[model samples]
Target: MKLKQFIAVAFTTLCLGAGTSRAQPVELTFANALSLPQVEPYQRAVDEFNAANPDIKVKMINTPWVEYWQQRRVDTASGKLPDVWLFVPGFGAEWLYGNKLLPLNKYTDADPTINLPDANQTMLKYMTLNGKLYGIGYDFNGQVVYYNPKLFDEAGVAYPKDGWTTDDLATAARTISKKLNGNGRKVWGFAGASAEWVFEGWFRGFNSRMITDDGKYGANNEGGAQTISFFMDMIKDGVMPIPDQKDPNAQAQSLFIGGTAAMALGVGHATYIFSDAGVDFGIARLPVGPAGQVGTGLGGAYVISADTRYPDAAYKFLAYITSGPVLAKVVTTGVPARTSAWGKLSDRMTEFAGKVQGFEPFNAVKGSFQVMDIQKRVLSEVWNGSKDVPAGLAQIATEADAALAKAAAK
Candidate 1:
């Protein structure tokens, strides 16, 4: 499909250029999961950094998110790794952290510019192995609800507010679905990337979770059950489709861009894509559940690969990427990762400014922790499966116990 959005940022200032200084260049290799507009900004940042210190040169390597892992694993086995790398901390992180990634706590203590105290604790919580820090963050993403404004106006439903409940939003989504489409049109009221992330919002709204505090299967817990039942209710209400294509790989952004679905739970990186479509859209916090409001978090932080030849240089890259200058480029096109930079791009979401009818409900809901517990993969064997919903949840918990045990045994 044609790209629904072209990143609006200019590359002139953010492009790679010559290294400054009279010293020999110390080249560093940076690796990321995929090609994104951030690449240019990163490249630009490298140029600026290199200009200040002519001794350092940098080369960036790009790989698909899916394929990135396969390459990393192969590289790890052979002892060839990039200097600066971005990788998740749980399932994949543990592997590299165990064998290859350098412990970041060492530099965190020695580097004055690298403030371990100010570093987002949530990221540290995930990247730290037992008790030591081992990574730096490139971006921090905040998620919200993205909806079509034109559809809402035609549906004649009142626009959603920040404190709006799930039921209220679902009613509106369903109602809008019926009204906006001509008789027998195929438009869906709401759709998204996956049921997992949406359910993450649901559990948070209800002030609950799919796993226990100690990371046990609590999928059958009252709160977890409520979260699941709510989606099933949405399916019955025609606000959501039956669990047919819950593939973790399916994208929520595509659904909105293609206009196949009216609303979705979206993260910060999406605004660039959605806004590019020239369709009217806006964002708000995820809807409130019967219990409360909630949100989930994810990251693309910097980690010092154990295979990195220059640990100091990689650590320098980590700190540089999270600074204010780099963040300006990130938040404008993608989501903001730093507390200082959070909400910087809210004004640029043109659709929200023009229509005044999108994502208001999400804005009302309070934000919360986005944990990186290593349990989702085990749970997905059921959630992303064709098994009966309730039974699948029960089995998720059981399987979680088994997986944790297996991990512990090692």
Candidate 2:
């Protein structure tokens, strides 16, 4: 329970000066879901900010990820939202449509200290709805392929390079698995490719998409078949595992970390996980699809509530936390939304320098999570050989279209 209860707080000092002393500093409630090591840097930043600004104090409320979001929804309904909180990316449509957030464009535009351009446009795009900015991004994640070079060398397989295509990925995976198998090693060439987020990239590569431009399911066609077929072929070739249905993400990560898998499709923060495992890995941009390279992209941003009584003080803290210097220290998992802060990351994440700039968000559509769930169920059947690609995709499209329509009706 201690892991779930970590909170960041700093004492406020009433400054002694000509007509500057106040009975109480303006207190702002700041909330985030980060726990443990991730929250350490964030606490330090809040303490530093509180010490520097005697007039304003930020009290941090930290909770586990699911509990935090559940609490946020309750707070939003009760009209008692935090003065400022982390605006998770996928919740954009829900929060914005529900009028739970205050548009920060005026604050960002007027503040001379705010570096709007330092934030990645993709992250900003998620925050923006109808041309109005809702928040300032603190950090972001972009997808990439993580490969173990030691496994590659041992298997005598050449390392994957940027701009490699799906065909190229298949070849490399097959070669590595084949060579390692011949050597009596139990390692598979890749893991986690069937993950919904990772699969979205391959969907793009094969000129298929999860949703149409009009926001309906788009994965019910030839291109969708090709993408599904490609993944099925990888499994049939024994290059990748049939994903763990209950939690494919964890399964993929653990397999790679435990050395049973040689490569994985992951996001920017995966460098930390792999590095902690002492794996010498190489990061490559997502492979090129028939159309072009693309993947799942999103991150967290700082947002003020529409109900906040102290917008000015809240904006100050938002700007402070999102500033390059603070983010360079606080953001340990993903790339800082600010490109300027990336230089502070260790060399192991060097592939992230400027590479995330090209990454664009695909899963930002309305009702995306609903559609993603449908894909997971139907695709799991396909991966398990219970359904053919065409039938699986048709089911996905049918079920996802209904879900999207139901969401719209709401």
Candidate 3:
């Protein structure tokens, strides 16, 4: 072979090698606000996904919930949203309606391997907007009463059961407080927090709607007044903690874990926290009001950005996290959104059998609503006793109606 023939052959080989190296895997960014124990399940899912898909690389970005939304707003305005992110139904509404999120129907419908129909129907409804699915719910959190068994035993008071009413709750709380308050160890019947999401259960128990069907404030009505008055009476009766008694930083969970309170209304996550704390705790359904048992469901979903450069890759990651196998692993931290995943979750809970109770009540919660910022502000003022419930709720209706009207006009 001559020198010219050798050079030509070498050039061809070099071009082929460059083309092969250019076929690299796509990289995607997945952002979430989950921390610590709750985050472990998510990290596990991400690791499994990365291991399974060598052609796609997923980078997990963890942010605190407070800063997460603020940063998302900034990212949205500048069109720098991550390929995938975790979002609650209410907060994610703006992004979905603004066309900033990718509609997941095409991917979900075409994928035979994924049993999308097995997901919790109520949760799936929340993730849908304008007849299109925007995201897939990974887990759900619902309200339950976390009570100390030792406290109840010490007071000689029977533990609360399903169908117990507000009156019963007050009686039990009063009995527990009275029996346990004699010593230096101060004990309260209940620890109340200022979060509106938690109080919605009480309002619903009275068969009241916080926001009317028309989207205007409705908490000023008969049921709302009754619910508010009952809580206020409890506070006056010395059964529930007052605003000044609660530490701003250490909320209900901390109080319960410290054994300072006999009972507290908390989310499903409290079961895991209590179990980890080695507290002899039990869970019960929220005490019923005139109507029946009711509470609010809180959870989030995995979504893909509309502006993502790799739609297929992003969808794959979203589906992977919400799939039955992955969700089963995460369900121990919260309720699974997939009905099939519940079986595996039950198996996992065996390790925590007698330590935790009231999981059924959390799973039974099927209703939920999105409370606006203005609504939260008014409710907070009322809960803190700085404003009268009727007056504050009426003001909320007026302002909320005006805002809705203005938006409608635009």
Candidate 4:
């Protein structure tokens, strides 16, 4: 028989047999960096999807965050990528440019039921590459200052407010340190991590473009130099802790939680950690810098692999997982990307409703641009005080430009 005739006959046979014997469901793999403890909402969403779609089944794979990137690199090289995975736009740009992941425009545009339009346009813009949508942001977050109210009251300094400038932060930190330090207490006014994300927030505050609008390295410019110099001066002036050369995040968290530090720069989730640690803390906007009160938003996205055998099913699953109702539950650590889901998140924040302030500023600021990967090491040198700010940023520009050029060539 001809191929068309055989297919017609096979379809009829399957239809006739459908009532008597069920067909095997299409199987797809979904992978992410979230650990088991943090994946309850995702698992629940998957369960609901599986229950509703008897013809498709999704298996979830989770890898530790520390090892996920390296493992994904190997998986991409071998064409072993899972059907769906989680990614960060800033870090996943090279992979998207290389076509390791599928462009989601066709899926999003063709599906009338898909709610991609409801996502924050600013965040959606970040997930786009060369005018093609590559992924959907699952959550949004940026930097905020978490302060100890008891410390503020004890030191007779008012809590930092939304429009406070960096100089104001320095003054508060200095006052707190002078009043509480010595006398065997060693209280620190501020604590910050040496991580790239933290530095990116400060850079944005100064209106510095780490990677210029045209995509060349520009971290050695005046704004960038001023940001680095300001933070280094904070450490030298004995207001902020000299961040640990290694594991700066852990050190900062320890100082803040142990009551040795009165203030710490952190993302939204810090509220929960401080609450759990029994710290009487309140949130505040990041201090306004030379440019204004601007900062960067860090978030995650859901991406599909280009080589998936089940593209249509994968797209359906993607839409299901990121839908407002599902994402409302999925977002525990950060703000949901969908405006519709914000109410659900506000409900979750009930524990600290009256105590915390400045969350409004985080929602208002959007990430300006993704920092180049090379900025981390060079900025670390400046933060750790081993290299002069000017010299380190100059080296950063050269190294970052070379890296960008090499990636472009690829």
Candidate 5:
């Protein structure tokens, strides 16, 4: 396809997948915020979808993450939003859902290929309100603890294992930081932000939550704070680094993948940083805390838009990108979302690392995650500095309760 024709089709279908209806030609626009330094894999999937569905055109709009929200807000406010788009479950999901910019409960057909073994109908219950499916898997990611094997050897500490607890992680950090590298310079043993979702994994590691089943915030929230406190104590004791802002890092990825930082509580998709850098990395389940191996967050869901001039066109494009071949391809890039393709994805990822030994650590702890509310309000405030976590969480709970109450009142 010529460049102009490709953009024409993609813009029309918003760059949907292959399973779309060829009989009906539809056009849509897909707005995405995945413009990381690397988007080749995403581009490949888009190209595949465009090739498969020539009639239903899908255009890919890339936005820098830093400025994406600003651009999206303008688009949404001006009613110029694309027909099909990529959205994080937080603000973006809430913005569309709240404004009625999305078509819900329409996409109920089971995508058998959307492989999440632990996922069932009940899990999809809230994804559809008043009986509608608002989203599908654009990309899926899982949370895990990542560490540098080289650091472990330096500390003379036993490396982390599948069933290791938070205390075990803290213990290791304490030991390693206490011992100086050749020149006695202290190296950080573990690090990550105090974000709610990040901490949620920690709390889940300890078996707790910031919210109750009826959409309430938990008592001892800031799972990351508690975890950080323990980690900071290690820092004070020479185990971790005091999270300073002067050059305060925003995330643990750069430090860990750069190999100076020893450990990080991060997502499965983070392997890209390491592989690209030729770093030696390893994974373990979220270190266990008091609750005996907890995990509580899952990411990714795909959805179409009401504004889309070409609705069915987008679905077709969506199918092509998320199905067999492309799905496998996504794995080679980073963490993949589908369960059916796990064998291929695992093999592909392992091979990408030149048959590295520790990639399966994530696969081992895959069973522990639970679905969080698909609400953006709470997630944003908690994860994205909408407010301080404890205060933000409390505020979020109150807001959610009010929203739920209003729904009940209706």
Candidate 6:
């Protein structure tokens, strides 16, 4: 389609009924925050959707993650938001509560081919809030520890198993950190100890809640203190590095890719990076603490703007891209959000399939993003040993409770 034609179609906001016909195909603006290299798979799915449905043409709007939120805010205020855009449940709470996203329940109810029943219920539940479905999840992810077996072998430590305790993890980590390579290159035992989501995962493992079901702050107790102490001890023991608090994910990924970290806590998508780097690793469920195994879940979905002119076409594209087969093929890094796609996943993450739960409890609340901001800032101090654990947790509780109360007032 020509640029002019695409622009024209994007502004043509007629709600076409089911089975409606038109001489020209409906075009939609599909905005995504994925970076250039990471988006090829999604682009391929878009191409497939455009080719198969001659009646709909979806145009790509690529915004890298660094500038995505800023651009999205500008677009939203100017009434120029894309017809369909990507949504992250906890991170996009501002958009959700502002009522800028179109509810998908009606469309899903009318369209059987969308196959609402086939999606992972855990991911689907996150996409819905206050009885309204805002988006259809395409992929699901959670923080899991990926370990280097060679490092474990060299250190004479047993490889971490699915049901391993946090104590078992500490033993392996401490042992591995003590071993140096032939050239005397130091290899840390673990990375991602300071990452916000990874920290959340450990806290979950300790049965600590960051946010309660009632939407209040809940991480200021004994469990939260123990979780903090655990990771702090790891860093103090020289088993983990003090990561860049602002961008711990990148640092964690870098350490693991460089083979300087024997085991790293990362999201399910980090497998792709490890594979691309030719790193030898084994996936293990997060270690069990008193609460049993647990970790933080994060994922993305396709959502329509409430201001969209082409709701029908947008819904069509949303449904197509998020379907089982397309997601199974395109979402190589993360687990597809459809139950039927589970069988197609490779053996690397097969054990995690049906075993790990990817729903993040904080995403259930109204001001989670604000709460997370508080978490990231305050916990950085705690992680660096500049602030006491008890003090940090108390500050988080105060700030997060205030943020939630403010959001509730709105």
Off by over 4 Å in 6: 1-27, 38-57, 64-68, 78-81, 175-188, 250-260, 307-312, 328-335, 339-367, 403-410
In candidate 3, stretches whose alpha carbon ends up further than 4 angstroms from where it belongs are: 1-22, 34-48, 62-67, 117-122, 154-156, 174-187, 244-260, 327-387, 399-410
lDDT at 157 for candidate 6? Answer: 86
CA-lDDT, candidates in order: 0.59, 0.79, 0.72, 0.74, 0.55, 0.79
State the TM-score for model 5: 0.64
- Which digits, one per residue and each the tens of the lDDT, describe model 2 over residues 1-410? 55444432111222234246455899999999996998888989999999999889999999898888789879977989999998776555667666778888888788877878777777788688778888888877777778888888988888888778778888888888887886566788878754454466667777888876577888788888998888789898889999878787678789888877888877666778888888777887777788887665777888889889999999899889988898899987767888888887888675664555656665655587888888898889999999999999999989999988887666
Per-residue accuracy of model 3 over 162-200 as CA lDDT, tens digit each: 778888888888899988887577788887644355555
Model 2 is weakest, by summed lDDT over 10 consecutive residues, at 7-16
Better of 1 and 3 by lDDT: 3
lDDT of 4: 0.74
Question: Which of the two candidates, 5 or 6, achieves a greater TM-score against the reference?
Answer: 6
Which lDDT tens digits does candidate 1 get at residues 91-165? 353454355778877777877876555445545555665677666655545456788777777677777777788
Off by over 4 Å in 1: 1-29, 34-41, 54-67, 74-82, 95-100, 103-125, 128-131, 174-188, 211-215, 243-262, 306-313, 327-333, 339-388, 399-410
- The global Cα lDDT (0 to 1) of model 3 is 0.72
How do all the candidates rank in terms of TM-score, highest first?
A: 2, 4, 6, 3, 1, 5
Off by over 4 Å in 2: 1-24, 154-156, 183-187, 254-260, 352-355
The residue-level lDDT of candidate 6 at 223 comes to 86
Model 4: lowest-lDDT 10 consecutive positions:
359-368
The lDDT, on a scale of 0 to 1, for candidate 5 is 0.55
User: Least accurate stretch of 10 residues (summed lDDT) in model 1?
Assistant: 360-369
C-alpha lDDT of residue 319 in model 5? 58
Per-residue lDDT over 1-410 for candidate 6, one digit per residue giving the tens place of the 0 to 100 score: 69999777666644343236557888899998885665898888889888999888889888888688788889987999999988877667778778899998889888868777788666677777799998988777777788888888888888888788999888888888876544767898888864354466677778788777687877799988888888889888878888677887788889988888998877766777787788888888888898877666657788899999889888888888888888887776668888777777866666555445654533545687788789889888987889999999999999999999998786
lDDT of 6: 0.79
Clashes of each: 16, 2, 0, 0, 35, 0
